[model samples]
Target: MTTHPAPAATEIAESTSDASLARTRRRSAEIEEQIAADPGRFRVLTGDRPTGNLHLGHYFGSLLNRVRLQRAGVETFVLIADYQVITDRDGVGPIRDRVLSLLADYLAVGIDPDAATIFTHSAVPALNQLMLPFLSLVTDAELRRNPTVKSELDATGERPMSGLMLTYPVHQSADILFCKANLVPVGKDQLPHLEQARVVARRFDERYGRPEGTDAPVFPQPEALLSDAASVLGTDGQKMSKSRGNTIELGMDADTTARVLKRAVTDADRHITYDPAARPEVSNLVLLTALASGRDPEAVAAEIGDGGGAALKRAATEAVNEMLAPIRARRAELAADPGYLLRVLRDGNARANAIAEATLGEVREAMHMAY
Candidate 1:
């Protein structure tokens, strides 16, 4: 009889990490192929934090994808990540109002409540319960290595790091898994978070899933649905963010939109061009115009050749205002009726709670805690 030596801890860890990466890559490719073949066949989970009103960046980046996916008959769940707001902010005093505002914004932007399931994070207690088991599946080193966490910490400068902030990626896994979501639309920068969720799903399934021959897993590994939308820049030409105060809110009135655009930074060049690197500020406006007017960026530039920064800004402003008119009107209508908005959220929460409870039952059973 021959005896095989057990692998060292470091070797075991390395092997596990490599396997996780392989699974993620394979799953990602499968999802892409699946989407191409039949987009309506998969469940999608995507959402936003209720830190503030959404902007053009949110519109182009993820909301647009949500609308399209829902319309295409994909089962979509839009989460109001209220718990995540405290991950960075010092207080939750404003979160309630922000959550309501976010819901209104969702409605204003054409997300039909009847078509997609929209729910608040706090409304579903099962998701938070799942976080405990999920936290154990991920490692401290892995959480610390998350680029999103690192960037956020670095950006905070001297702010104290909270345990919640470090484990946010794990919480995200709970969010994704609770819905059994197979597809999560995210930007390139968010790939790491999605990858972590996939890792957690695979780990849980391997540990507590059905017998080997059955191959039944309670959670389905989610894959990232990377968006191809052009990056939306802020008024200062940086990434559009509410914190930076450079974002053009989706609900901004036509006059406010135009005023914000007028203050947008641009170069001294008299000619309009589409050189993002050399002229990011000007190029940003051109791209915005293209997105709003449904015209090519180069074509927009050609239409305004030698028109100077003033002319380019004016044209972009006009295009943006025109695009925002209907959205603003809809937002106003939604915001005026607080009772209706509350009812929408209440109904969504009930639906989400039922689904979450069912998932939690399975999770508990798999972990031998059913008694």
Candidate 2:
């Protein structure tokens, strides 16, 4: 029999790229279809770094998806990424308090503790241990090429990146795989992190999963649950972030929300418009009002036409306050009893630890390191 030639490296690369693109397109369609159809049940993993209070950006970006998925019968895991805070920070000052505050915000936003497991990253020892083996599966070039890490470095303007910062994507892989989460709700900007996690999962399965006639993978390759929510902007017309102090906190009172919006930057034109390129500040406000009031941004702009910046700001402020009133009330009620918050964390940690321990045992067995 004549031997056949193996596929060239370039051909292999092209094939992989095409496959990835197809998967992405399919996932996008799935998200759109999910709106009309029940998602059945899937394990979803998503979280936040308890850097500060959760804001509108957090709400529209991922928190809303979390609540929806949890209610849709999906087993959701919300990790308070406490360990990720040190990636850029000089110290972990009052991280405990911050974690509690973040948890309170989750509760306030209707993240039912009984429905979704909310655990601190540091509380799960096996998750950290899972990182050690995963680091070897990734390369330096791959980590450096990650857009999220590059953006962090560029934004910080610092040299000699911290090892933890560089390997953050890998650590994130462990976080997702430790729970074997097959669905991760993320914005388009965060797709890279989720993709890297998929790479890690594939690598591990290829290296150790195939045994004789059996193919058993320990981790499920997660897909991105892309959201259709509009991009939320800070009061300064920039990306909404806690570091910039431009966020509208979820727990803000009515007056505080109005004062913040009143100072929001806008164009000097008397008429309202939705041209983001021409007037980002005004467009940002329109987008915020649209999200808060469940109206189209263009419609919102048309309704406020010839009303000037004052009217636009007033509408945005009213919409935000109206949406936040009940949330703020619930948050205040939850925040009053610190003991209740602690108990929730403790219960979540215990459940998460049990799942992580089981996963770590399987990982150890696959690597031939199990005793």
Candidate 3:
């Protein structure tokens, strides 16, 4: 006992931990520099509320790109915004089933289990927590001025919308900022929400957090990834949507998809053409046909031009049916064990929550708002 003093365990552990953190910091900075240079490796937080199953509109608009991105090395997170359903409605009656249906749809579309993490909104409380402090960053008038909220209110004829719906953008900011998400895959209408997230992240960082030089950007202002593809239309040639019950669900079987497409409106002129403005109905059909055939719409139009609207419709129907055949089979297989879908949700929730918790902690620490 009189010979020598022993080394402290705490000192050894701290030394090793500091070394590991330095290595991790250097690696992360390198990856960030690479993304800054290449651009497409941008991390994105994108999702659809699990109010219903995904359909052709979702496929053509965003999900299609997401599938391509996953294959192309983009880090993507697919969220089932189940919590937002209650923002408009009163309960969660159909949401449980809808969530499962959405899961089946995602799996069918080749959203690899390894590539994208899919989860429900409510499952990530850390994300929701961002809502509290985020609320302080914006004015009530700013939320009221959001054009998208106004459009939804107009479309649904819901006067005096819920506070949750009014501030849905804040929640969306939470969805992005919680993951520290920087690149958002968005349609034109969604530009405002991304704008709001940028504002809050910038404002909060300026007010209570640190700035990077001349000005600080706490959050990387997410850039909009735009799409010029024709939107998927429903049977009646209106926008394909779940609320209208006009959507051809991706999870539906081949027979069901074929049946849905068979009933969709086609051009009355019969000759195939690419005039979307003149014949949205037929043009939508032609567009779907082109995507399914892996040919340009101009090419599809040329091939089917001799045929009248009925023939064009029939050809469009057949092409869609052919493309959906395997997807339908895969969906049925997934549907057999519905629990597998729930498991995906659960696993995604765990991962998203962990990341979100870390983000929320940093946000709280920055603002000195931690309780």
Best candidate according to TM-score: 2
Better of 2 and 3 by lDDT: 2
Give the distance in Å from residue 267's predicted Cα in candidate 1 to where it truly belongs: 0.9
Tens digits of per-residue lDDT for model 2 on 1-371?
22212232122223226575567667767764774475554788889998889999989887887888888778889999999999988988899888999999999998999998999999999999999988877767667767777787788775778999999989998889999998887765677788778887877876667333446688887887766777889999998999898999998889999999999999889899999989999999999999999999999999999999999999999999999999999999988888999999999999999999989888887888877
Per-residue lDDT, model 1, residue 218, is 86
Better of 1 and 3 by lDDT: 1
Stretches of candidate 1 off by over 4 Å are 1-33, 155-160, 211-215
lDDT of each: 0.83, 0.85, 0.75
Per-residue lDDT of 1-371 in model 1, one digit per residue for the tens?
Answer: 32212232232234236565566556667776776678777998988888888999988888877887777778889999999988877788687788889999999888899978899999999989999888777667667667767777788894768989999988988889998998888765676777778788877876677433445798886776766678889999998988899999988887888889889999888999999999999999999999999999999999999999889989998988888889889999999998999999999899899999989988888888888
RMSD of each: 4.6, 4.4, 13.1
Worst 10 residues of 2 by lDDT: 3-12
| lDDT (Cα) of model 3 | 0.75
Model 3 per-residue lDDT at 247 = 83
How well does candidate 2 match the true structure in TM-score terms? 0.90
Worst 10 residues of 1 by lDDT: 2-11
Output the number of the lDDT-best candidate.
2
TM-score of each: 0.90, 0.90, 0.84
Say which prediction, candidate 1 or candidate 2, comes out ahead on TM-score: 2
Whichever of 2 and 3 has more TM-score, that candidate is 2
